[model samples]
Target: TKKALIIGSGIAGIAAAIRLAVKGFDVEVFEGNSYPGGKLSEIQLGEYRFDAGPSLFTLPEQVDAVFQLAGKEPKEYFAYDKLDVTCQYFWEDGTSLKAYADLNRFAKEVQSKLGEAELSIHEALRQSAFIYNSLAPLFMNRSLHRFDTWTNPLALKSYLRMGKLGIFSTMNEANQKQFTHPKLIQLFNRYATYNGSNPYETPATLNIIPHLEFNIGAFFPKKGMHDITQSLFKLSEELGVNYHFGQKVERVLVEAGVAKGIRAKGEDHYADLVVNNMDMVNAYKTILKDQRQPKLLLKQAKSSSALIFYWGVKRDFPELDLHNIFFSDNYPLEFEHIFKRGTIYEDPTIYLNITSTHKNDDAPAGCMNWFTMINVPNNQGQDWDQMIAEAKRNIIHKLNRILKTDVESLIEVEEILDPRTIESKTSSAQGALYGNSSNNKFAAFLRHANYSSSIKNLYFCGGSVHPGGGIPLCLLSAKIMTEMVEG
Candidate 1:
């Protein structure tokens, strides 16, 4: 059997291993951490259990597809429930909205609360669906670097509607044009943060993000998000894939532009093919140091990182659900602080996710596990210690004002994940949540390809590579990467 070596046990790496195993290859996974799952792992804070990364779950069919590909019933191994209320939004002005999974219901909610016409919501979603349907085939499901992709009939069809695809405008511009209410526009513009980009700068083609939540629907894993990694890791092992924990891969062994294997723990392990699930920039800088680098792709602006405070709250509020967002008073200025000023905004938009809302066991009987986070600039030698301290004060102040409770007093335990720790823990380049910001329209094309252009048999997958970040896209990155591998 051909041997395959996967560097990193992230969701994408595990998925790639499963793919290779199904193709009858002997696969070995090397992870620096003691456990599998890079960002999609879990953490425990006293009596509270938090999904340490990527709290929101969507595109569940992508997870099911992997199990089905292995000829197993997905539900038997994994399961999740679609969220009826995808997210509850709160503004400082006492305005609140529930983003219902049903389009018509959500439209009604927007109209009733924000005073925007239901038709505006309907029209925005329709445009979102149109963009998603048109672009997914060309930009996502396949490799943008491949000539065959552009020549596909779907690509040709998409070309005919390029002008309508929102590529020319910013996400903010598109939202402003779509809605009259400032709050509604802000709500739609927030979707740009889904991939760690600024709505004010990211191309409006990202408007497709709303379709994933409002149209296809958002979901929550029956367990927590970490189950996504655990289940896939189990499946890979069941398929005879081996895993080496605490084995930090030092370098990719390449001879005459062909990948031989990798070096880890002072020994060389050879394989027929190699897959890199490390951040693309880190892979190029560390593992593939001897190889020619894709300078332009690596030089693109890094995506915004996150400052997460995992708190075990002593109290639970019924108003908040699985996902909730507290809007900042000045959205544009907030992004400006993150992207341009390289600092945290005083009134930053806060995303508070409590898995305990769905899985009662995640917290104590009357408590909750709060995964509170805010967008921040990726590590660039900024004073993180000062920033984290100030951000925490701001977060507590905002929560206290909006929830009408003393947030600082409610925290029974606390754990913080900042840009510095995120980089140290996950090996994401400068701790970027997504590899590169989609601030420019060409960012989709600028992302590193799944397969190395110069090195034969060396492949890349994960949030850092093609298809962009988030769970679904990382899975797609693996699919796209492995498709180029030969059995």
Candidate 2:
């Protein structure tokens, strides 16, 4: 059997390992960390348990497909429930809205709360669906650099309808055109942040993000988000994929322009093929140092990073659910602070995720594990200690004002994950959650392809590669890379 070597144990890498093992290859996964799930790991702070990264779960079919591919029952290994209320949105001006999974209910809620017409909400959602349906197959399912992708009849039809995708205008511009109220427009524009892009500059084609959550519905693993990593790792092990923890790969051994294997800890491991699950920029700079670097691709603007405060609160608020968003009064100015100014906004849009709302063991009785996050620029040698201190003050003030509670007094324990820590932990270049920001129209084509254009028998997967970031796209990158490898 052919031997396959994988560089990381993230969801994408684990998925790829399982796929290759099923294909009759001897698969081995090398993970630098002691545990699996690069950013998708878990952390226990005092009595509270929090998913260290990626709190939200969507497009579960992608995960199910992996088990199905391995001839195993998905439910037997992993399970989740569709969320009825996707998120509760709050504004500083005493306004609130519940985004329901049912479009009709969501439309009525928007009409009642924001005073926007129901028909307008329905139409906006329809447009989002249209964009998703038209472009997902072309942009996401297949490699964009491949000629066969562009020549397909479906691709031609999608291309002909590109004008309707709002690719020419910014997401803010498109939202302003569609909604009369500022609050409604802000709600739609927030979707750009799903991939860490600025709505003010990113093309409105990204508006399709709303359809994934509100239309298909957001979900939560039955155990918690970390369970996703645990279950997938379990499945991979069951499929005979060997995992090497705490073994950091030092380099990708290339000879005469072909990838032969990898070198780690003063030793070499040979394989028929190598799949890199590390960040594309780091892979080139650190591992594949001998190979000619794609300077232009590496130089592309990086996506925003996150500053997360994991708090174990002494009490729980009934008004809060699995997911909640506290909007900044000025959305454009907030993005300006992140993308342009490279700092954190004082009144940043606050996201609080409490898995304890569903999983009782995540926190003790009457307590909640708060995964509080705010978007900030990627690490660029700023005074992060000072920034983190200032951000904490502002975040507490905003939460107190909105929730009518002294948030600081309720916290019994706290731990922080900043850009610097994220970079050190996951090896993501500059700790960018998403590899590259889609601030410009051409960003989609600029992402690193699944397979090396020059090197033979080498492939790439994960957030930094083709199809983009987030859980679903990361899984798709694995699928795309595996297909390229098999072919």
Candidate 3:
């Protein structure tokens, strides 16, 4: 059997290992951390348990497909419940909206609360579905670098309808034209942050995001978001994929322009093929330093990072759900601070995820685990210590004002994850949650291809590479990358 070596035990890496093992390869995964899941790991704060990263779960069928590919039932290993209310959105102006999972109910809610026309909400979602259905085949499910992808009948059909797919306008522009209410526009525009892009600048093609939540449905793992990684990790091991935890890879051993294997922990392990699930930028700079670099792709602006405060609140708020958003008073100005100014805004939009809403034991009785986060610029030699301090003050003040309580007093436990810590822990380039910003239309095409063009038996998967970021895309990245492999 051919031997396959994978670097990193991230969700994508684990998925790739399972696929390779099922293909009859001897797969081994090397992880720098002692644990699996990378950012999808969990943290214990006193009596509270919080999912460390990637709280939102969507496109669960992708995860199911992994188990199905391995001839196992996904439900036997993992389970999730579709949320009736996807998210609760709150604005500083005393306005609130519950984003119901049912599209018709949600549209009616928008009409009732925001005073927006129900037809407008329906039309916006219709556009989102159109974009997703049209482009997902060519851009998402297949490798864009391959000529066959562009020449496929479905791809050709999608290209013909590109203009109508919202490629030319920005996400904000598309939302502005679709809805009359500014709050409605803001709610829709927030989808850009799903991939860590600025809605005001990212191509309107990203409007396809809303369809995933409101249309298909939002889901939470029965155990918590960390269960996503734990379940997959279990599946991979059951498939005979070996894991070497805390063994950091030092270099990708290349000879005469072909990847042979990897060197880690002062030892060399050879494999028939090497798959990289690490951040594309960091991987190139460190392990593949001597190899030819895709400088242009590496230089493209990075997606936004986050400053997360894992707060173990002493009490629960019924108004909040598994997912909640607190809108900034000045949305555009906040983006300017994050993307252009490279600073956190005083009034930044906040995302508060409370897993205890569904998984009661995640917190103590009458308590909640608040995974509070704000989008901030990627690391660029900024004073994060000071920034974190100031940002916390701002966040507490905003939460107190909106929730009508002293949020600062409710915290019984607290932990912070900033860009610096994210970079150190996950090895994401500059702590970017996603690989690259889709601020420009060409970003999808510009993402690193699944397979190395120059090096034989080398492949890339995960958020930093083709397709894009988030758990679903990262899993899709693995599927796309591994399809090129031949046993």
lDDT of 1 at 297: 92
Global Cα RMSD, each model: 0.7, 0.8, 0.7
Each prediction's number of clashing residue pairs: 0, 0, 0
Candidate 2 shows a clash count of 0
The digit string of per-residue lDDT tens for model 3 on 103-173 reads: 88988899999788999988888899999999988889999998899788998899789789988899999
Q: How accurate is candidate 3 locally (lDDT)?
A: 0.93
- Candidate 2 per-residue lDDT, tens place, 270-388, comes to 99999999999999888988798898899999999999999999997999999999999988899999999999989999999999999999999999999999999999999999999
Candidate 1, after superposition: displacement of residue 223 in Å? Answer: 0.4
Candidate 1 Cα RMSD after full superposition onto the native fold (Å) = 0.7
What lDDT would candidate 1 get against the real structure?
Answer: 0.94
Candidate 3 global TM-score:
0.99
Clashing pairs in 1: none
Pairs that collide in candidate 3 are: none
All models: lDDT?
A: 0.94, 0.93, 0.93
